[model samples]
Target chain A: MKHVIALDIGSTSTRAALIARDGTVLDHLRRASGHERGAQAVAECVLDFIAELRDRGLRKYGEAARGVGVAVPGAVDEGRGLALFSANLGWRDVPMRSLLSRPLRNLPVALGHDVRSAGLAEARLGAAQDKDRFLFLSLGDGIAGAVVTGGRIESGAHGFGGEFGHLRVRPGGRRCACGAVGCLETVASVPAIAEAWARASGDPTATAVHAARAAAYGAPRATRIWRQAVAAIADAVVAGIGLLDPRTVVVGGELAAVGDILFVPLRAAIAERLTFQAPPEVVPAALRDTASCQGVALLAWDLLAEAQR
Target chain B: MKHVIALDIGSTSTRAALIARDGTVLDHLRRASGHERGAQAVAECVLDFIAELRDRGLRKYGEAARGVGVAVPGAVDEGRGLALFSANLGWRDVPMRSLLSRPLRNLPVALGHDVRSAGLAEARLGAAQDKDRFLFLSLGDGIAGAVVTGGRIESGAHGFGGEFGHLRVRPGGRRCACGAVGCLETVASVPAIAEAWARASGDPTATAVHAARAAAYGAPRATRIWRQAVAAIADAVVAGIGLLDPRTVVVGGELAAVGDILFVPLRAAIAERLTFQAPPEVVPAALRDTASCQGVALLAWDLLAEAQR
Candidate 1:
């Protein structure tokens, strides 16, 4: 029974899974990412988690795991196996592959961007399955996107391709953390929506989910906030459609969990904004939280295949 | 001397060339496109031009031309060999390949978008030569762009990819011919700049060239209009850089001919707008008017290679 160890290191949580070649999760583990402790500590925690997952796979499957795939947030140099920069993790140019391979006895390691890895999973085994060209957007704490073409993710020349969140949808609108004004993330991301809803509704702790529910219940203020977010997202999506001409747009992350609340108005807004571009089908992601794990597992399998060749 | 007959059908003129496999123009011809006469007449003129170029190639090379590649404006269904629609040529769903092939005794015909083909030429033989990932932007009467990656153009799923001109830069601004408001084309295209310059300079005949020259000479009105156009163009290019992350941005078409006038401030504006993304080299195209013909010639050569395989 061939299997691989997959790990996804996000901002707050680290997820590990023993995945079979067919994308089934044989076992899973979760832990606090501890990114607040510092980058080195987080790296140590990741290594320990991978070791635990590998031991579990060996004990159950009675064989060694084929390879390890690690999906990290922020800019990555996949070809060089470096985690270039991650604001969430406070890391820069961490030699991830060498650091992992040393303790793992020279096991092959594959490194990829977390959002892009999830997009690969969606393209191959989830929402956009069998789609050769599509855009994968994750509307989470901050928005991120992946442009998949011909079954491969376009990482661009400098690993900055598909930076959808930074696209300026509203000129001179809001200041983003990335030092850009009027970025899509400043208006449509989960935190952005929550902040706007909280201010408008006078509920200091209101979340995006609360805003969606209020909008669904026909609250004018919440409806306006949700509608503005949806419109901004649609504007960015329309711009992406004009540039990429994708066949489908697979959206995931926290907001998509509300289903029709986010999708219904989103679809309508996109249709209203489109003029000459072809309309791409907008659908929810199927894999949910485990998408990055599954995607990284696929990367591990690819590494094994490459090693064989 | 193996060669191909390449024809570029623009709105005002049809240009033909006998091109060697190495991308050299062995011979060239030009005639009125006759698009004003109607779609049918334009199609006839294109076919006639191709036949004439084929005869010339045969006479000079002492052999039959291998294939024909036609570069047309507007939407193109390259896989189906159909010219889907062209606002300039006023044609829709023209069976370009069959029409040319039948008259030329079953010679293979390749159909391509004029802007995309020109981009291919720039990618392969012009300014972006040796660059595997780049964006080729033609700033003509209207702006158009092509995203070239891994030595191939991304035509998108619906053939509408690289519609850079239609990217919305100013929200709720002037309406575009494509029925969209605030498109980059409405503010930065050659005609757009020319119109603004004409109105501001109180000269109905003023063109973009005049605006560039006047701005160069420090004329206040022309400088203001030129700066506004450059700012809009920079905004759109910044968006493209965020999405595609190309290594180079090759600027072509009529406006690029202004040399330092367009490149100087345009480069400065892009530099000012970029934040986190990698800055791509902004350079002028080398092939000029012959780019589309040479690009279509490359397409013709590709078809021949495919047939041999």
Candidate 2:
């Protein structure tokens, strides 16, 4: 049974998985990212995760992995196998795939943008699995998206195709870390929601989960905060629907975990906002955290196939 | 010397052209669309325009024409050659290609959305001619865009890929014709600019050209109005840059005719808004009004090729 090592190198943690050729997950592990220790340290950590996955795959499957796929959260130059820049990981121009693959006897490596990789996985094996044109948005600490068309996520000219988080929903509303004003991330992301709830509820230690719970329990202040967040997200989704016209919009990450609490109002808001454009089915993501792991594994398999050809 | 007839069915007028296989325009004609007369009349006008171009092509090129392509302004289901809905033309469910083709001895007809067809032309023969990934925006009475990637316009799932005009740049700012608040079209389109300038200058009969001229001549009120329009346009461009990440952005239509007056300020505003996203080279459309005609011709040629294959 041929297998590939897939690693999702996130800012918080590095998750490694051994994916079989038949799209089954054999084993997986998670480790600290070491992102705070800077680029070189983070690269070493990713390599360590890859080595552990490889060893496990060899012992279990009795075959050295055919290839590896690494999904990085940043501006990735996938063709060049470089992690161009990531504010969260404190990395720039890191030759990610080369460095990670060098220690593994020069095995082939596939590097991809995290959201796009996740989108690919979703399109191939999750909620958007049967949809040809779809959008995958992960609303976590910050919001990012994957624009999938014809069963593939568009990487754009500069590998910046799916940066939906930065779409300015408010022209002069709030300043973002990216030096842009009124970015969608500043209004609808988990941190943004938490901060808004903290301000509204006058609770210094308020979190997004607390706000959701409070809103669910019919707290006025938390409801307003949650509604505001939902409105902003709906606004962004409306714009996305108009621009991309995806058949289905699959949302993942922490915010979507709230289920119907978020989706019901979101659908209504989007419905109110849209006129000429057809409203797409806004659904929750199928795969949770394991999406990137499986997605990158698919990319690795594709890379292996291309190398053989 | 096989040629194809291409027609751009605009609301006000239908422009027809005979295009050679080598992408040269042989002859062309324009006629007022009797859109108010009914969908049947409008279809007749389109057929007339095609017939005239075909005759011209036969007489001049001395060869039997290959096929016809029509670029329709509205919600079009290109696969079925159906003009699903069009606010400007006041029509719905018009089987445009079949209506015209049935009269032309059942010659193959290729139908496309006007903006997407124009984008295809731009990608192949206009300002974005050399770029693989680009965006073409025509900011006339209404704002429409073509998202060109890999030299092909993304028609999206419902052929609404590049509707950049509808992106909610200002949430709850101004009411749009599409029933959305703060759409880019409400702020940056030619008619919107004209209306704003009319209000600012207290000139009831003011138009976008008048505003451009007044701004160019340093009229304070018109300059302020024009600056506001430019700022809004820049905001939309910023969001577009973040989302599509095109290599180039080509601005066309009547507003683009103002040249440096529009581009200078627009470029500056976009530069100010962009952070991590690479600023695409913002340029004016070279073919101007002829883009859609040539673009539809290209689509016709493509259809001809596909039919032969």
Query: Cα RMSD (Å) per model?
Result: 1.5, 1.7
Residue-by-residue lDDT tens digits, candidate 1, B1-309: 888889999888888888999999888888888889876677678777776777777788898889989998877877888887777778778888887778787788888888899999988788988998888889989898888877779888877778889998988899998888999899889999999999998899999999999999999999998998889889888888888788999999999999999999999999988887789999999998889999999998999999999
The DockQ-derived docking category for candidate 2 is: medium
lDDT per residue as tens, model 2, A99-159: 8777777688999888888888888888987898888899998788888766667777777
DockQ top scorer: 1
- When summed lDDT is taken over every stretch of 10 residues in candidate 2 chain A, the lowest stretch is A148-157
lDDT of 1 at B40: 68
The segments of candidate 2 whose C-alpha lies over 4 angstroms from its true place after superposition are A202-205, B202-205
Clashing pairs in 2: none
The DockQ of predicted model 1 stands at 0.84
DockQ value for model 2: 0.77
Calculate each model's fnat, 2 decimals: 0.81, 0.77
